[model samples]
Target: MSSIDPMWRLTCVYGELRTENRQRMWNTIVDLKNRSNLPWLVVGHFNEVLWQHEHMSETKRPEPQIRVFRDTLESCGLVDLGFTGVPFTFNNNQSGRKNVRVRLDKAVAIDSWRDLFAETEIKHLTTPCSDHSPIGLTLIKETSQPTVRKVRHYEIVWEKAPELEEIIANTWASLEHNGDLASKFYQQKLEDMSRDYFKDLFAADPNITPDEIVDLFETKVTNMMNEQLCAEFSDNEIADTLF
Candidate 1:
């Protein structure tokens, strides 16, 4: 179980139960199902394969255990999300041997809890640390829209312009005095200043070459020691500084 916040308990169990304990364990799970309304996910190495195809080798299938587990899940209104990637989760330790692995790590969720989560992803993560490859399950919360980070783009066209340095120095000084500007404000100001500066310079000389424009801006910005400005500015500061 993993938790990003301290308010909730995310529990996980690995039940390597014998045949006799299966019934008791199932009953206990059912009891737990009735007791909690919070979001809960129960998954791990159950040591029980649900289907014949889950195994890589064609050995005899444990019909009784599979049937019992499936029946219990159905009765409890739980869904087997089935396998996400590789059908099997475990491989026998016999190296280079023709042993088969079966899907042991399973994921199950209640019907009522389905819409609560944005997505449930299950996959096998490489386990160089152990013999068994670890199964990773992730529950992602849904967001209505994609999160966007603010980025400032600047164009400078002035050739050997001393005034450009002063402008940058003044902006930097203002930002330093403000301690930190809001993200939107910083982005807007930075973009506005950059556009205005370039517009004025280009308007003065429409025949300016691209390389000359770049060189002029580079010279002016370097004079202001703006190389580390990107690192110093936060999201908002960057936005404002560019404008």
Candidate 2:
């Protein structure tokens, strides 16, 4: 292999179906750890779950089974690399209460392997044909440029609102500052505004009650829209609404 190219010991496993047989596989992993010093990555359908949350079924996984798996990982010094996209990797494809889902497929690595590719990303892809979802891994190069910051684009409709200037002036006036402000403060405020988009837009003086805030919006929007604007939304709800 080229000197600049990354290299590691990759082991793909399809664990034994029986609980007793799986224990043998775990022992083999411990033996491998003792023999090899190379950065190691192990991935595949383990046929087991580490936590209750990883499984979704009417019947809970046995505590002893989880404990044994945890002990094996601890002995091997292997840590799970969490996945994105689908929450579960296996599905029974059944309906109603009979249905079951589990995160059985996974990727794990030793500490040195994790440090070697610190920007690794794991994802669980949709499985159309099989019962198990395929796990994918992305190893980001250390020399790669950092991700570009997302630019917050203002809605043209916001500029059309007559109250925009007054809202900005009120917010700036509320800040307690004397001389020139540092650039870091401006940068931080920009980030905050991007994160709390709607919350900051409708924010009022801290001294004003929620009722007073509603009264202020009475002139701007109808009762129904104002109600929605005042209503608290969860992060997921906001993402769903915006996207």
Candidate 3:
């Protein structure tokens, strides 16, 4: 048993062990405790199950190997972190032919060591080539919050009953002025107005088009001019207005 850090220490034992070898395994655990300091984790395949129920398949005769494993665990003052999902660690893939499964792999830690591994997880993965499904262990680490960037907002406005020639004329007139302030002010105001109008129109009918709005504005102006011309007294003017 060696201390990896001030808080963490690990000891492992591997390989197959029969009933006769149980005493040697227990002796190893006892020696490690007498040799190592506090706050340690003991993990690996212990080839022995504490209970007959730990095996997925039914065993008609209870094995003395299980009793020895349980007693050794109690003697070492270790706590068993239960299997995450399926209890069996090895499978033969033969359902009824030669199905022999067992829980051999395990992780055991002291009481103080539990707090260091607060978010530990164990998962089993399917393996086509091997007899045992791969077991994966995960340790979650705390992370700081991510920084985010701010986004700028923009508004777009459309000109009402604006002829192409008039737009060009106004743009040139603004350019001819001493500063570009007038052009910028007009452009910004138009964009804001267009955005407001489009927002209202979109609320009413989201599919409204720019061309349709322009046509509507032109039609309204033409109708107003026609009405004013009609109100004039000259008969020739009324005729011209009607035409």
Candidate 4:
């Protein structure tokens, strides 16, 4: 995560030489674009250039392949930010006419980024021993606190019967925390027992909704509570187990 635009994501890709692999790379970018409308930046060694002029002293660049790359960016609503340091980001490092260079490395972003982060800048950096140039992205925006989400947990079905509460507690306390006969193993045993107890609920209806199952569990718990009350159990004892 960055200090600026914490909600946005920056994705980098190392593209392949083969045509099909390169097409897959652009398709991946479009997939990422569909995931969010937030400020996003996709940049890296794309290996394909949009224009013939991007290739220097090489054979005429393939048009159909470049068209796919352009179409992918258009569909994803991404625009090239254009570089600063050099014309060509990659070099074969070969000498004379054999030398091949193309502006394949790039930085692109969604249009909404201009509205949110108005002072963002892209800079190309020199690479010492690599074919591709490194890039620096500066997104200047006001920082806000990150949002936190709360997660909830449910306990085992203790609410079914008042007598079952003390029975389960004593049985659980007697088990070891680790080893073959551990609490975890016994907990799984209890879960299987509960499922077996509720097996008729599933068998009764071929298309029972999750809500219906929960409702059935609640009804069963309530009935158990009433049974405990009739057996002259204390109010506290009747409220023992919860599902």
Candidates, ranked, TM-score: 2, 4, 3, 1
Question: Which stretches of model 1 miss by more than 4 angstroms?
Answer: 1-10, 95-98, 141-243
Candidate 4, lDDT over the whole model: 0.73
Decide which is better by lDDT, 2 or 3. Answer: 2
Residue by residue across 1-243, what tens digits does model 3's lDDT show? 247744567887683556576688778887887786676677777777777876766343266667777877888788887657777777766644246787777777777777777776766545556677656666564567657765333431232334534654676686776357765755665565555666667365556556644543434448778888778488997799899
Clashes of each: 14, 0, 3, 3
Better of 2 and 3 by TM-score: 2
lDDT of each: 0.65, 0.80, 0.67, 0.73
List pairs with backbone clashes in candidate 2.
none
Report the lDDT of model 4 for residue 77: 83
Q: After superposition, how far is residue 169 of candidate 2 from its true place, in Å?
A: 60
Regions of model 3 farther than 4 Å from truth: 1-5, 60-63, 141-243
Q: What TM value does model 1 have?
A: 0.50
After the best TM-score superposition of candidate 2, give how far the Cα of residue 218 lies from its true spot, in angstroms: 43
Q: What is the C-alpha RMSD of each candidate to the true structure, in Å?
A: 24.3, 19.2, 28.1, 29.1
Stretches of model 4 off by over 4 angstroms after superposition? 1-6, 141-243
lDDT of 2 by residue, 32-56 (tens): 8888888999899898998998999
Instruction: Give the winner by TM-score: 1 or 3.
Output: 3
